[model samples]
Target: MWFSALSALWLAATAWAAVDRGEDGNIRSIALRTHTLKQPYLDSDMSSRWYDFGGDTVIRTDSYIRLSSDRPSQNGWLFSRVPLTATNWEIEVEFKISGKNQLYGDGFAMWLTKERGQLGPVFGHTNNFEGLGIFVDTYKNNRPGTVFPYVMAMVGDGKTPYNKDNDGKETEFAGCSARGIRNANIPTKLRLTYFQDKSLKLELQYKTEDEWLLCFETNEPPTIPSVTYLGFSAETGELSDNHDIISIDAKNLYTTAGSSTPSKKTPGRGGASKLAKQKEGGSWTWFFFKIIFFILAIGGGYVGWTAYRTNQKRSHRF
Candidate 1:
């Protein structure tokens, strides 16, 4: 009996240790190809959605989403309903600059936010550009001295705007150079990773069939809450510019604990809430299992030592 209990404890510890650290957190993704968008509608995969501020938009190739900013006040937004909580996650997409003009305003961005559903060029105009936005800037209006083809991760609430010209303290997260990914011609892949422990990393890469070249990396971390919806948007003012999204993939890194176990709660209108509760319960179960295993290991070790001592005593008497 003791041996069996010890073996079970050892197996339990091993199983817990073998749990994949980088599991995709059971995140579900949506593809943008199946859904069609009207001119003013948002483009979305089944998992996430997008919205445009009124303009001529069309689905060109089955995989590519296109927008035309003929109207001066045109803007586009693709947002997800997921709330921003403190968790680890990642968002990646492919973007290309289709057409260009003199004042193309701001091109587009990958946003993780909790802003009230008003979408437009939140970077140049207002203080509500809060949360985080990875901006691909075509127009150098914000940074007059700099040339085109730049990327930046904008953080902080939409209440403060980062001044591109000033070095210190105009905005929260400032712009960075993405000279490698900007081709004005070809497409490039952008990826952002957020750790629940307040660590954020950004990577811009050029993708080819055989390999991916990493363009830019940042030492700074993302300054947003844990759980937030991941999405994209674009805006244009005077100078006409259009940004196209080829694809998007997002994964939630934080999984609720004990998700595998069944719950006793009566399922009702609060299905989502109940599901969340079950996840929390699963986490507790995992924790409890770990504690039990530890206790068993200690007890088994003591018993084994006692048996060894008893055997030694018998041999000495003989």
Candidate 2:
């Protein structure tokens, strides 16, 4: 049994090693786009690779492409200049949303559509698109029982309106509420994987410090036509936030392993601050607090008992 396990591991490792990863460690991708979003003339320098549409969208040197802010009625989109040519592709992006308004909203979106810069109702873009729309909905447009910061996906056939009142429950192919994503101490990571006609998977790390949580996966045939562009859009209505995309890494999967299944580290791992994990979920600090609280409670009881005993002894002496 041990020999068989070792052999299996060896075989998998060998197969992985056989694939060619170029000098940049990018495997089999025909086109790779990586941007830190930190140049003075970013819009110009990236004009050939990216385009910004709508209002109040700015590229900041501090490390993000700002889509929209707390400003009401603000809407914008940043799109890829070139189409996603690869049949199987993966895109990883680090993003965060923070601003005033405790009841923040209209959220953000990531798109793989046949068209670009078309704005309408679906998170600042036109509805009925002919591709995939991944919504990182921050506010509760509807659905009272559901939590905020819901992440959902919809395949557009260029017709159906995303039922926002139901929180897209009607149109949503798959979705889940991802708490701790907005204003996370560390940027949340969003990874999307589409393997041709096989499957589409979405993973979200509420906090950069945590492991990727598989939000949802669907095997339904994508209603989207050939994806021509990739981009992000955001809007603000009564509520708002600073929707920012820190960085994006897009890669073609077909080149790396022809018709191969998705790998364990499909989008690769992230290096985030350890302290950030505490903000999202319980950590060593939680245990430490429990221990300290227990000790303090015991000490308080002991002190009270000692004082009471002393008072009784004094009264007896009297």
Best by lDDT: 2
Candidate 1 lDDT over 212-236, as tens digits, reads 4443344446557555555566666
For model 2, what is the alpha-carbon lDDT of residue 183? 79
- Looking at model 1, report the run of 10 residues with the lowest lDDT sum: 31-40
Task: Find the number of clashing residue pairs for candidate 2.
Answer: 3
State the local distance difference test value for candidate 1.
0.56
Q: Whole-model lDDT for model 2 versus the true structure? A: 0.73
Q: What clash count goes with each model? A: 23, 3
> Each candidate: RMSD to true structure?
14.5, 19.4
Cα RMSD of predicted structure 1: 14.5
Task: Report how far off residue 312 is in candidate 1 (Å).
Answer: 50
Could you tell me which 10 consecutive residues in candidate 2 have the lowest summed lDDT?
266-275
Give the runs in model 1 whose Cα sits over 4 Å from its true position: 1-61, 67-71, 84-86, 100-105, 123-126, 142-145, 162-169, 172-174, 180-186, 207-220, 254-318
